[model samples]
Target: MNDKLTRFLFEDRAVRGEVVQLQGSYQSVLESYHYPKPIAQLLGELMAAASLLTATLKFKGEVSLQIQSEGAVKYAVINGTHDQRLRGVARWDEGLQELPTEFSSLFKKGVLAITLAPKDKERYQGVVALDKDSLAACLENYFLQSEQLLTKVYLATSLDSAPKAAGMLLQIVPPTSETYQGGDNKDFEHLAMFADTTKSNELLELNPEVLIHRLFNEEDIRLFETQDVLFECDCSKARSAQALQNVAKTELLTMIDEDGDIKMDCQFCHQQYVFDAVDIENIHNDNFDAFNSDGRIDERTLKH
Candidate 1:
């Protein structure tokens, strides 16, 4: 399936929905590392969830969905931007030859954190416990606690050699005094009932139009234009250089003395950036061009 996110609205019910399917982007994430089946599956769900939630952003920024746990999986996160770019990674126990199959066992004592960072506005974050068996259920609870908007989420992922993930989100639009007359809780529940009947394979394989029809054939639905979603990592040599600036000049030089160079690897995409003694010197001099001559990453230029 093509990587796309589609938004739709229930004309009379005051409800909004989004459906997202990922194939190429999903493969890009899985190829970055040799993730176990369970980890890959979990990352796939997180990727889909990130795509669905990022669509709600009205400003220019990114959304980060992270899970911190003390179970077999230590940490997992997916980052998505307002324009639908996504990247994700997961960290698991390195010693385990075979990962556990039980969902609860995999993420013991886990907490899910959803953060929205806008470029020109203050950031907001919501935290919730991962007490549910599925990621979808956890997200549903997050919306309930944070926004108090009746919401439902369904996430599904394929475990085959070529991984794919898809998700659907339904939310009740906040009611205003004039618009709240007939758009009651029952209307939202009626549509949610149809959404709950979606099968995993159907969500993973079916196209958006067909899937929407299957679920809400009788409802007055207005499907919006599709938005493209892809796996694009923001890591680059320039950003790596900027990150190094956070370290003291003396410390950076000491690292070069010990190892002959500094290496930075992005966990999300596994791309490596190497900086030698000269590169470190240039970094300390505030010379960004030496490392980012190609202009691969958009780094801020500092005035001397």
Candidate 2:
């Protein structure tokens, strides 16, 4: 199944919205990683929320919505590109509960940090205390405090759908010069309060058109063309080699001597990059780029 992300604009007022649904796309991320129920659910929610956030960005780059904590579940992160390509993973302690219903049960005390990075521009980050009852609530507050604009986010996921993570967001766009408030922003305030009543079922199960219509029937809404979202990870052995260059030759050579190989992993996709003695020598030697263990480097790949 193809993944879908849609954005909507309100014709009558200064507000916008987005709705996303993942079916096969969500399940695909789960195939290689075996996560506990709570982590899986956390990943699903993060994936859905990230997709919505990525679409709402007014710039050209991507957004990383990371959830880190000091409790048993130390970290849970989801990174999503502006093109809708998403990939993420989590780390946690064992003997945890198999089933988790409340969002707080996953992490006793965590912080949701959001960093906005554009390809050719400066990066900006905002931190939100996980003091709220739910992740969505915390993000809503983040929008209010950071942007000073009203925003609401709703996300949901299920394994029964086998790999789909879907979610929706509704927010008021800051007023344009022409629409600047004079006395009171009664209309914008009403819209934001209305969005607070959005149900999880509507966010998870409804079609984009039907969902928005149900929520904003009194206002005129404009829908944008839908875009495709993908589960793509930008990782390669060459990129791995670049990172290795920063390590000391003596240390890497010693690791190879002990384990007979140098192995590395990509935290985002959990991809393993293994390098043996010959591989380690190449990195330290002058001809690091010229030598390759037989059949190790795929010859046809393009460099990043």
Candidate 3:
């Protein structure tokens, strides 16, 4: 099935939920690299989680889920935008033969960082230790510690032939009244119980509507319009050029002199951007004016 993210609200209870199923997008991410089974599955789950979290953004921006560790899996991150475009990449230690399935074993001392970068505002970030066995639990802990909201996350992935990922999120809406005594606990608990029972296979195989209906048939659910999610890397030659501008001009020139050209590869999409001597000269002369004020390269100046 095509990738999609769906949001639903409980009319009778003060709660909100989101469900996302990823297939084509998940496969697109894995196609760029030959990841191990455990790492691939972890990346898929991170992608699904990033999509679900990105849907919750109230502004035009992107949300990134990053895990940094000192274990075999050094770094893994997934980026998702408000529009649902997603991309991810991971790096691991060389000469590592076996990767453990547990989070603690994979990341002996790691931190899970969630960053929210808005298009027109300051960015916000939160970090939590990866003490839990599962990414879902670690994210839940993040919500509890950072937002102080009762949140539950369920993530699943299938790394077989056709890779896929699915995730569900439920958060309790805070009480508006000052005198309201936390009566929504029971309601949130009731819904979370059902969501927890979701099976990995079911989540990967079933559609959003069917899955929701099967899980929360008794609740009055207001399903919103589905949003399409796809794997799209935002990297471009212009961005790469701008990055080159950040380096010392002498360094870039030296690289061009030694290698005949400077080649930069995007880790997420594996797209290579090559900068020849002429391109480097243009970048230095124009002082990056080859790019417009909007940060996009001018069509006339682009060579590749």
Candidate 4:
């Protein structure tokens, strides 16, 4: 299978970039929920955007890209670690849109939040309202405001026969060493403008080398090897059990009384975990992980 995401350095300049193409991974996230088409596309874009954002930061822990609103789109978020493990989910109101709609339609009005957490250090968060037309533009505004750098991003998604979502980032890094060779800010600007001319199809279909040459043929360029972006969710039954422990005992009993069994499902991967009265009581009594029904996870519950 073709690798889903790849990070590359220009080598000539301080700018570094990444390209993410998602098909199976994107589709798996979409399959987790029956969201509207607009929401699906938004989730795809957000996932790709999150991957690109994580690449920018040489982080050792977690980074989450979240867009929350009280309007049509309640929440759309993607989480990734430094290892490039990614998962995303989106929630929206009724009414299915046949195709990808505008960002305003998906998130009527809301703020974007980016939280970066390092394992042994304090977590950092940045928030900004959706004053721009697209999520891509919103993120670009975020980069300019938070990092105080001139950054540009090109995001494209094709809803055609072969759905592919791709994105690119261009950022200028100030030289830090005594033997520093300064970058021409004006040249970076021109290069970004040229990158802005890229099309969605070209991003999705064309080979990376071809695409780079098409965008920056005039400039000396180098491309790195690709990394796979696989369809994987980190949700598990153990985590669900931990959640059960967190819920109040009264609420757990009420859920069992009302619904026969409490069925909790993970939004990221849509995996369901069902619990009965005995299970709830055990959760309340013991802080242990979990045990199967029939009071046995060993030979007693064994099948004939």
lDDT of each: 0.87, 0.74, 0.85, 0.72
The TM-score ranking, best first, is 3, 1, 2, 4
Task: Provide the clashing-pair count of each candidate structure.
Answer: 0, 4, 0, 0
Q: Model 2 residue 40 lDDT? A: 80
How big is the positional error of residue 275 in model 2, measured in Å on the Cα after superposition? 2.2
Cα lDDT tens digits, model 4, 20-128, are 7777777777777776667777877887787788777765987898888877888888888776678888777655444336777555569899999887789999998
Per lDDT, what order, best first?
Answer: 1, 3, 2, 4
lDDT of 3 by residue, 54-172 (tens): 98888999899999999988999998999999999888876787888876788968999999999978999999999888999999888877777789899999877788899999987
TM-score computed on alpha carbons, candidate 2: 0.84
Clashes of 2: 4
Evaluate model 3: give its TM-score: 0.92
- Which is the winner by TM-score between candidate 1 and candidate 4? 1
Q: Where's the lowest-lDDT run of ten residues in candidate 3?
A: 295-304
Error of 4 at 23 (Å): 0.8
lDDT of 1 by residue, 1-304 (tens): 6899999999999889999999999999999889898999999999999999999887899999999999889999899999999998888998988998766678878999999999868999999999988889999888877877778999999977668999999988876623423234998889988998999999998999899999999999999999999999888888778777777888878887888778777777877788787887888888988766443333222211
1-304, model 2: which lDDT tens digit per residue?
4688989998878778888987655776776478777678778888888898999777888889888887657787777888888877777876665545677765666889999989779999999887777777888888877766667787776666455567778777775634423334666677767776777667667787888788888888899999898888776665666567667878877887777777777665667778766765676674445433222232121111
Most TM-score-accurate candidate? 3
- What 10-residue stretch in candidate 4 is worst by lDDT? 295-304
- After superposition on all C-alphas, the RMSD of every candidate to the true structure, in Å, is 4.3, 5.4, 3.9, 6.3
Worst 10 residues of 1 by lDDT: 295-304
TM-score, every prediction: 0.91, 0.84, 0.92, 0.83
